[model samples]
Target: MAEQASPEAKYQLGTPENKQFLDEQRESLMAFGHRFPSPGGSSYWLGDDGTPWTDRNRETWITCRMTHVYSLGVLVGHPGAAELVDAGLKGLRGELHDDANGGWYPAVTPTGDYTPDKQAYAHAFVLLAASSATLIGRPGAQELLDDAEEIFLKYFWDAHEGLSVDTWNTEFTELDPYRGLNANMHSVEAFLAVADVTGDEGWRDRAGRIIAHVTKWASENEWRIPEHFTSDWKPALEFNRDKPDDQFKPYGATPGHGIEWARLITQYALSAKIDEAEKQRLVDIAEHLFARAVADGWNADGAPGIVYTTDWEGKPVVHDRMHWTLAEAINTSSTLARVTGKDVYLNWYSTFLQYLDANVIDHKNGSWFHQLDCENKLMTTVWPGKSDLYHATQSMMIPLRDPSLSISVATKEG
Candidate 1:
């Protein structure tokens, strides 16, 4: 279990101290991610102490996240934020994008070769970053948004099934048989952002369709949404059991995803053009998801942090504590507290913040440690270097914004 909040500790939700903590963290993250831009505008993975790990490939998803983060920085009036956003835009428009092909490349290899497959996961982040950039009136952002939306609709999104497909060959001709919920989850996020930025209610309805499928699956599976799926969208429960910690495609249920889905579903419910009764029903489902993920993931191994994955029976399969999981926990707990007016969720928020300070946040380094063992010791077996600031930055910002609005839009309005 997370240690009890110290008597003088000040992370209680809605308090000035909590706000200040989040503000400080947000600023620190902005500073840490300042070094993300590469020569080609794609993001460089940051090593400990905020140095770019150039040995790694520059990825479209990371670049999009940095673009989205710096766009938020611009809205918040952070110095030099626009330049970083421009750099990310340049990458998205140039190296990270496939001018020969339709959509963005998954990554630019170190040897200057692009990766083979074009993935929905990376494209979703492109849509999100473009939406956020467009909100801030960044140069060429609208063009990027139009391109991303068109490519995604053409290659990834299946209007008939109401769910996005997973991956395709570079030519967009051959689709991979493996479907996934991770990409779709982020699609829901991007859809919400695009809908808000463009004032197109159709995107919101699309997000609703995805959410309906997820909530139904989560409810039937004891609140643990199936991550892996077949081409036909059947749950592939045992897909990666031999490689239980495959980073992106981990086996078993991902409790962090449940926590994240809860937040997104809450945002969708609040933002959807639906009646109060329908919104309340959606919120109820979100609450169930939040409760079950916390019950299954948090302290499942008698530890101080949430575990990475759990079995169908709710047993921990991967005991590592991922930084993003805790971030989502903090975000969802605060969100559920606000939407439901429940102190229990607020207490969980405080607990997660305390856990972040004690276990995840690296005082010596800038950003949070990306991964830690079950014993709360820093480990990078899954995530080697610190990724982009998207998850952690949003974790700080979301608690301070209206649950119904996207973070970039909310930050802009404020």
Candidate 2:
């Protein structure tokens, strides 16, 4: 068993050494923002060689993530950060926006034609991006937030089901029967940000509803929350069994998402200031989710890292280790420590940091490696290049916050 350190010594997340390391990491991440802006939107992919892949189409999800990240950059006073944020605003206002369809497109070609699908996964990020930008008082951000909220309420939200639907046609005429926890998971995250920025209790209530729904499902399913579902919210447990490594809709439970949900639910519970009983219930669910993810994900595959997905029985399905998984594990462990004052969470935090230091951070290349094989060597089957800064950046920043504030709000007030 790992020896426990005193809380004063174990809370190394706020130490100056970690702060300096995070600052350096932020600097490296901001360097990539300069290459993201294009005519269509933020480019969907960046080559590992640190160049934007112009051949790849622009995507709303990537654009929104960049917007949210650069808004943080602006909050932190990074040089040239405002330019990227403005570029993202321009894209949201111009090409990505569907003047006829009413919601943003999932992707647009470089020449500016919108993709056919409008997805909740991407739109949730739009809500998040707009929320962060509005908090920073960016021009047009309020309008964007208003529009995103309207679209969400009008099209995606299924109040009867207490969850958001997965996708719709470009004109919002056809709804896909497929429901997904992934989109709702992100919706909870976006709702929290909206609540923080707008002081909207409604958004927080919606987040709590989603959290309650998912937590119930997770508890009934042995903590391996199902990702896919039908129109009436029936679990589609075998939705992607043939494609076990699909990037978005993988076959089995995503441990990273389990951990991510754990962190978000804890944040929601704290920020909403629920009654002690409700708060404790949320915390208990979060602890169970995190514990299950760590046990099934970390090193279950004869390697010293978290696997991307796991079967219902807690066996590794996709043995590849994703950088985002460890990032969320680090974040949830840190938050659990801060919330519960538990030494075990602190010990897990230290262990995750060691794993990240040895396997994930690409000290030679700048940002962390996005994916690795079972043996922990760099591999790029699912994700090519450092396409996102949101997860890793928050992993470094979450430890320094009050746990109630979303990362954007926390950074602004820090």
Candidate 3:
């Protein structure tokens, strides 16, 4: 038999071969532009077989993610990327925008009627997309960014709580009592990107406040950050206990959110330029968060992959694996390796890369598998066809640049 390769022999970050692979992966993701862009917004879903499913309504989050991805493509000199970015911009300004309500809709049907709900999660992505497009020097991007910020601050932001609310009516008439950490996490990400693009310190400071609040919650909860919350910013640990894998609002601690928060908090520390003491505090917290997530998540349920959600006591709650969780694991490991210069993180990085290579990457399809069961077989229990390229594309690109700068700016400078 041929000699079985050791783990180190499989793949390593920063190697020339790995760099070339990342480039090819990026190219493959950029090819998705051909199927995503519609006159209204990007299509909400793409079949696992690589067919565009445009019958579903267009989503604001999908449009924003595609715009952000194509903006990165434009920055990297990919052909035809600017057109896709422009199409996304048009979506933001036209069909997706609620001209009467002064905010973007969560979803818009093919006939142009939009869902009445306005969500902070979708709005945060709008900010992120606009910021990236602004960095790429796209026309009307600055205006979009300005409008997104104004609406977010005026309606969604709660200065007393230091976090964005979960949802609102289209006219901002009423707010949902259900709060969430997911939106706040993405808000931090969007704020950082806006800070980078605008050269403004306020946005970064706002992100810091949000991080401080969430990190406190994470610390108090032993780093298994709670997902659902009351409108008053209290953790509702039992929320959705019956439906543990309800896609967006899952119950219990989400391991993927912890990993993502680790990466984002590290980036915040680097970009904010805090004093040594404060920086070290943030770094220590990030390390704790990442370690806890890895311990509770990776292969905890007699399987060789991370579980989706776990209970407060560190037992697996949802055994199914999610591709985005693995992607976040790769990203957090990469960031920690770079920040701490630790070989252990690099080793973890290599291991996860092996998992991704063997299981997640759908060579037959154009994108990675969205969900896999505990046995590592492809499934769609939580996510349908490859919805969007945001997570996977960012995972591939994040390791190539400095963790301090936003990925778009880092790619542009590089």
Candidate 4:
């Protein structure tokens, strides 16, 4: 067993290391703004020297990504959040309108590459942010909303396969078109956000189509999503399979994606709540995920909560550190509680939240550790403690609303 941390240690002002994560972000964002220029920019940049910036970095690392901040806006309308809305909306618009290709590039790396994968992930953010902006009556968000819808509908949607791509192959030398649960799940999330934000009948109709595609995939595949597929939705055989044989299952069989599928189905359920038949459809998906996750990979006392993969019959294997899975579990379970009016989801969420607060949260740092054993113990790793980007990067969004937990106690990231 590992040494237990005191509540004060766990709950007090977090490690100084955590503060540096955001400081680096704040400072780098500051630097990125002035040194790099883009076709469009927002006002949130500070410099590497922490100076004020006049230029744009298209990515707008700190400001646009302030999911925590945006969550803050959602939960309490924090002062900083209210101040940044216009700027955030503008950045979302610029990102959407970017490139002649009809979708936005991912971001500006240090070398200042546009890196236009035109990913569904960032576009998902576009949906969420635009929705939030519209909620607050921000002026420019409507056009951004239109831009997001157009790109998703025209560029990424694959009618035959019934899924969306993580990104396009246009920029790469060899054409390697791909679709994955991660991207398409994000597309589902984006559509849901837009539908809720606009409250338009058309948005809801579109959201239903996307959700149905996702549900069809999950329904046919044991409530698990494959990691990669061709544009037409055939599995990408022998592509990313060198790890461990058992680990190859859900891809042929994997556990992490079950959590993601659950998360999407959870959102789809919540999005489909207004109509009785739609709500029933979503409920079926949610129950299937819960039942499937329980059957395939969950351990009542395991560290990962779910196994990474199973045989063709659905079994758990290769219990490891998967941040995305864990994050999805937390969010999906929590959302299920909210949507179903069932106390069970809340109870499950509370249990998961307690575990996370005790483990993965890295009160010593700003972000999360990637993995641990299935029993909630930390694992030593080259990628241990802090990661620049991952699904857990946004985990704090929900927890921040829990004041007694001290997520807002200012451990890391300013």
Instruction: Put down candidate 1 lDDT per residue, 268-357, tens digits, no spaces.
Output: 999998999999999999988888888899999988899999999999999999999999999999899898998788788889998898
Query: How much does candidate 1 score in TM-score?
Result: 0.98
Which pairs clash inside model 2? none
lDDT, residue 110, candidate 4: 41
Candidate 3: lDDT over CA atoms? 0.87
Q: Best lDDT goes to which candidate?
A: 1
Each candidate's TM vs. the true structure? Answer: 0.98, 0.96, 0.97, 0.67
What TM-score does prediction 3 earn? 0.97
Question: In angstroms, how far off is 376's CA in candidate 4?
Answer: 4.5
Tell me, what's the RMSD of every candidate?
1.3, 2.0, 2.5, 8.4
Indicate the TM-score of model 4: 0.67
Candidate closest to the true structure, highest TM-score? 1
lDDT of 2 by residue, 1-414 (tens): 123444333335667776676677777777755688886455557777567887777888988998998899998898888878888988887788999879998888866666898899999999999999998888899999999999999998888777999999998999999999999999999999999999998999889888889999999998889999988888999898999999899998999999999999999989886898999999999999998988888878777888999889998989999988888988898899999998778788877777777778887776789999999998989988888778887787787777888889999889
**lDDT for model 4:** 0.51
Question: What lDDT does the true structure give each of the candidates?
Answer: 0.92, 0.86, 0.87, 0.51
Model 2 spans > 4 angstroms off: 1-11
Model 3 lDDT per residue over 1-414, tens place = 011235654357778877777778878877854578776655556778657777778889989998999899988888998988898899999989989989998888877677888999999999999999999889999999999999999988888878889899878899889999889999999999999989988889889999999889999999999888887888999999999999899989988999999999999999886898898899889989988988998889777788999999989999888989988988888898999998778788888888888899888877899899989998987888888888998888898888988898888889
Q: Give the distance in Å from residue 201's predicted Cα in candidate 1 to where it truly belongs.
A: 1.0
**lDDT pick, better of 2 and 3:** 3
Per-candidate clashes, comma-separated: 0, 0, 0, 19
Candidate ranking under TM-score, highest first, comes to: 1, 3, 2, 4
